[model samples]
Target: MIDVILADGFSMLTTTLILEALRFVNLAHRRKAFDWTIKGVQSQSPRASNGFTFSAQRSFEANAEPAELVFLNASYFPDAAASPELLAWLRNA
Candidate 1:
């Protein structure tokens, strides 16, 4: 799994849980700035820094790390949506 460790162990945990839940349905995700979208949920573009892992580790002894998951984008997804209902609409279309 790709990891984008920004900050806040709690937030990271939440992101991890959501990430895993989406994976079960074979979710396709991508990043562009902070523009994030999911098939069946509110679209929230998480802001993560590219230098979190190495830099944060050395700087603040962070618990999370940042890795490239750029390929996980809307274009690769099977019908994009801000929400699952929207995904359903996309499928129908």
Candidate 2:
């Protein structure tokens, strides 16, 4: 499984491209080749720099399970989205 951490003000284009690429891989394989979860600092959806919201599957937690791969999506003012909890989680991950 892959975990995509959606920081506030994340880059919509980059995020979409990554997701679509993964989706295409699965489509080409004709099966669910990869599974991923979108995570955010909060349970609510994370807003993108373009004023769009993307639904997050879950919030970051200290005890959350680590994925085989992880991607952190951030854009403008990315440092603003780095909470201590998130930093800790990333460190452990």
Q: Model 1: per-residue lDDT, tens digit, 1-93?
A: 333222221233445455566564454444323332222112233222221221222211122232333122222222332345433433343
lDDT of each: 0.31, 0.85
lDDT of 1: 0.31
TM-score of each: 0.22, 0.91
Off by over 4 Å in 1: 1-10, 27-93
Predicted structure with the largest TM-score when compared to the true one = 2
The sequence of per-residue lDDT tens digits that candidate 2 reaches over residues 5-56 is 8888899998999899999999999999999988886545888989999889
CA-RMSD of model 2:
1.2
RMSD of each: 15.6, 1.2
Consecutive 10-residue window with the lowest summed lDDT within model 1? 53-62
Error at 44, model 1, angstroms: 14
